[model samples]
Target: MAVLKEKKLGAELRSVLEAAFPGQEARYFLPMSIGNAPEHADEGAALILEGRKTLTSSPLWDYLDGTIPFVGALGVLLDGAGQPRGVVETTCVEIMPFRAVTEDMVRAYGEGERTLEWWQSVIGNLYRTSAIRHGATFTEDTPLIWEWFRVVRRL
Candidate 1:
């Protein structure tokens, strides 16, 4: 189950965090998508390591209290294989609607085309599918948490 995998990942990440930062405390160990399609986890991790992809987005409802990313929060990037590949420090976070996602955000996403049209098409389909599974509705006004981060270390 995803929960069990996440628990295992948490333990592994705790060890990595201890070895990497020694005394520092990590805010979270984010596994891109638990049970859903990985989407761009591998490419995104690679981009982060290369100092290219610095932005990411998630549905606001996904987090408790609609919490957005914090300025110095550290995250461990997990690959499709559920392996830790790198660490990133959040630099900025913005709350916006899906339709308001910018061209810059699309480019930073580092996915195919890097155009707003392309981004919309892809995200729309994804959101629609998710909404169907949850018995919800998808719309352009769907709230999203946009985060910009920088890779601090590669594992």
Candidate 2:
């Protein structure tokens, strides 16, 4: 996969957002595929660009600590190479336990046949890995932040 410096990618994203939303306050430009491998980052960005993926889940603690992402936010999706791929606007946010994640929400995620079983298998692994890395515990009761977004512009 192609790679660029994060600073360069951020600058490019800023320019695109500025031109697209002139005179508006700048919005956050975020890299995609947190807690996953580089290839998954590429896949996630592609899914967003194709408009197949609209919802993403993360550990609720991340949001509470202001690490990244929030409701009603705008972000530029970045591929594995750290290239800006598109812009997205968050439309909804929900905080719930992992067990509470609905099949409908997983379907909206639009990954791997969009099945609940697939979501469980994939996200369960991701959460487990992230938990180990962060010294946290992963369980069905683990808090999650589910965010729904819409692609507003493709670059």
Candidate 3:
């Protein structure tokens, strides 16, 4: 198995995604492999361009694993030199929305609650402004994970 040496995984991923789609908004979702995770299905991260957080799901906590599920999103902006113009937006989502506090999971993370770290992790990743429509699909404007890795490995 190959190890990920890239310091900024999110930044690197954003560039490749943007290159695949010039002047267009692109989105991606990849599984996050957390080392030393409990016995359960590994969750994934949903990456997308900056300022776009319309695609997201509810907090999904796996009772089997004590570790929290993480979802990440990103946006890549480039200039004439092909360098990073700017990062428009970024977000993260957690599966388990109501497991942080025993006394009041909802109260702790809900609109009005304790407002702890876990709550931020769960709510921050979500896109509250918009919601996923019925029967929607990704446009696949950029190369898939495998394809992008193949080229990068050759470099």
Candidate 4:
């Protein structure tokens, strides 16, 4: 795999630092977007910034062995256009089966219907689409990377 050795933070991230924490050193991890659609991403980012959304469920297959998110890891959340919007740090991480996700876990996201059924349906659709894109199979027992995060700074 190709790796970038030394690169500066992007313009969006720089602006966020300048606005919220000038001259303070910060290190954020992967670049991630909340949702696939621009409008959906915007809404999710808003909820996150307002402390309304605290949880995210991601497909575990997206990560290789030992590549899963860990507690205290920092990541930059980007908008649909790939512009950084906020920095979030993972406070907890769990690997669980999709069908086994609990209501509490879904409610922790703090958005939409705030119910397990709603979350299952929405996430199921998203994951299903992703599976098709990647030529993979998705099932009720699919493992998921469930992360709980807190906003560090918002742009």
Best by lDDT: 4
Q: Per-residue lDDT of 49-154 in model 3, one digit per residue for the tens?
A: 2211222223211111333222323333333233333332223343332223333432322232434554344443331211133122222121111101111110
Poorest 10 consecutive residues by lDDT, candidate 2: 1-10
Identify the leading candidate in terms of TM-score: 2
Instruction: Estimate every model's Cα lDDT from 0 to 1.
Output: 0.66, 0.69, 0.27, 0.70
Is candidate 3 or 4 superior in TM-score?
4
- lDDT string for model 2 (1-155, tens) is 11111322356667777776666544554545433456867887887788888888877544434555566567777776766687788788777888886788877877776878877887788788777977899999997877788988887
Which residue pairs clash in candidate 2? none
**Candidate 2's error at 121, in angstroms?**
2.0
Model 1 lDDT tens row, 1-118: 0101222237677777667766667465443422354545566556667876677777654554544568776667777677788777788888888899888878887666879998
lDDT of 2: 0.69
For candidate 1, what is the lDDT?
Answer: 0.66
lDDT of 2 at 35: 30
Local lDDT at 154 for model 2: 83
Positional deviation of residue 149's Cα in model 1 after best superposition, in angstroms: 0.8
Candidate 3 TM-score, C-alpha based: 0.19
**Shift in Å, residue 139, candidate 1:** 0.9
Between the candidate structures 1 and 2, which one is better when assessed by lDDT?
2
**Model 3, residue 130: C-alpha shift (Å):** 31
